[model samples]
Target: MKTRIVRVLVTDDHPIVLDGVTLALQNTPWLQVAGYARSGREAITAVERLKPDVVLLDLRLPDMLGPEVVQALRAQDSAVKIILFTAYPDHAALDAALAAGAHGAVVKDTERDDLVDAIRRVMAGERVLCINAAGSSGAALSRKLREHGLTRREYDILRRVAMGETNPEIAVALGLTRNTVKTYLQRTLEKLGARNRVEALSRASQLGIL
Candidate 1:
């Protein structure tokens, strides 16, 4: 008997990641790339129109978070299984994705064979969590970030900084003094193991702070 081809819709804000995954799945015998999308809205539209059997989604999207997208897809009452495919992996993110109705979780670096296995498992009504996630802390900056004891306001400032805001601009926007903004940014960097704004933002984004 011929094996069934599992139709999949892949979503990611980064075009390169989306194309890479789609191409990887193209040769899988039991899987078919139903379609691919670049953002949360496009992913939703594709799901509505194509109704693929499974959806591979990115956690941090331009318009919506991965959990938000998962919830939205579930709200549509579609039986299409969702797998959170992200570059950053941790226990917290995976838990959130699962809570939002994702059937599995995989990172960007997942081996093609492992990715194929994840999709196959999800199609068979199993919840799949990639190997990397098993030992990951899942929280932003891993738990050590929290150990530094940064405040929520500090994280907020760092998030804005990640979006490319300057100290003066952040101060103006947050109604704080320039000194205060500078102080917060420095503290955030120190706590997150960053030497500068770029490194801070990169590390924080990896930990899902952004």
Candidate 2:
């Protein structure tokens, strides 16, 4: 039986980058290029019309930043999957994207196959982050915090909170109740020896967890 193709919308201000992404997706059997856009407004329009399963979004759109674009898309349709594509993969940026409801992130310099793999993984319902490219700092932070004995879920919640997401947003993303999110946040704070969310975020950054 033939596999279903994952429809994708590619958005970037640069024509060359857009072409490169289209070419890469063309080589992947399970991915179908549905549309391309050169600006945030165009991307939003295409998303509204095409409703592709995945959107490969560049962080530096001509009209808007990637995080804002993702937030706008999410506000329009909560189920729309957005994969942040960028050259700069700083922890702060990654956290912003996550908070804005992006499903995955891939660096612009990522290998073609790895990019394809990320798309497939996100399609398969796994949150994808290019750890080597986009998350080295965050990964190191996570490692240091692991020594403190925080549960995986609590750690995840803490990271999300550090990214500026509210408990309700984190709960929705993680499929936890509002009270459960609060409880996890409290436990995470205790584990990090933090007095508050801001303190925890700062400590996590120092320890390399954000």
Candidate 3:
């Protein structure tokens, strides 16, 4: 019998990381490194162009957040599974990643064997949520979000605002009125102790809120 080969695209900005990961995957007979990307935009483009079966994506990209990438890819209606490979290892970030439709996650320092296992597990039609040893759980992320007093609507507004969408544009995109977006954004800012949109996004990322 022959082993099934998994087509994988690995994305990371660091050359060393890319090289290391490529080397690691070379040891796995069933995994093929189809392509590589160095930025969020490149990764998105590669996904479309290369059409890999799975993506091992770094959570912190030079051009966009990992969850944002997940959301963007899904919005394009592609069914390719994505696994976040991040060093940040924040529980809240993982929660947001999972929420955005990521198929799995693994910390940057994950052992070669473990990462291979995670990829196989995800390909086998299971959700993988392997966190770093020091990472928090989904429950902790929910608690923090609740403690910050942000409603789901407010979170949505903040994400649009973070992407530099105007009130009218956000309204149109979210199917809400401009006033509603403005209201939710204001409340989101207040809840996050931010005085402006940029600060709100910065604080939200720091808190792993988005």
Worst 10 residues of 2 by lDDT: 133-142
lDDT tens per residue, model 1, 62-81: 77555557878877656989
Supply candidate 1's per-residue lDDT for 59: 81
For each candidate, what TM-score against the reference?
0.67, 0.64, 0.79
Best by TM-score: 3
In Å, residue 92's CA in model 2 sits off its true spot by 3.2
lDDT tens digits, residues 134-201, model 2? 55645643565567777767767875674457999998999989999998888888888899987886
**Ranking under TM-score, best-scoring first?**
3, 1, 2
Q: What are the Cα lDDT values of the candidates?
A: 0.76, 0.78, 0.81
Best-matching candidate per lDDT: 3
1 or 2, which is superior by TM-score? Answer: 1
The C-alpha stretches of model 3 lying farther than 4 A from their native spots are: 133-135, 139-153, 160-178, 190-199
User: Which clashing pairs does model 3 show?
Assistant: none
Each candidate structure's count of clashing pairs: 3, 3, 0
Inter-residue clash pairs, candidate 2: 141-208, 141-209, 142-209
Assess candidate 3 and give its TM-score to the true structure.
Answer: 0.79
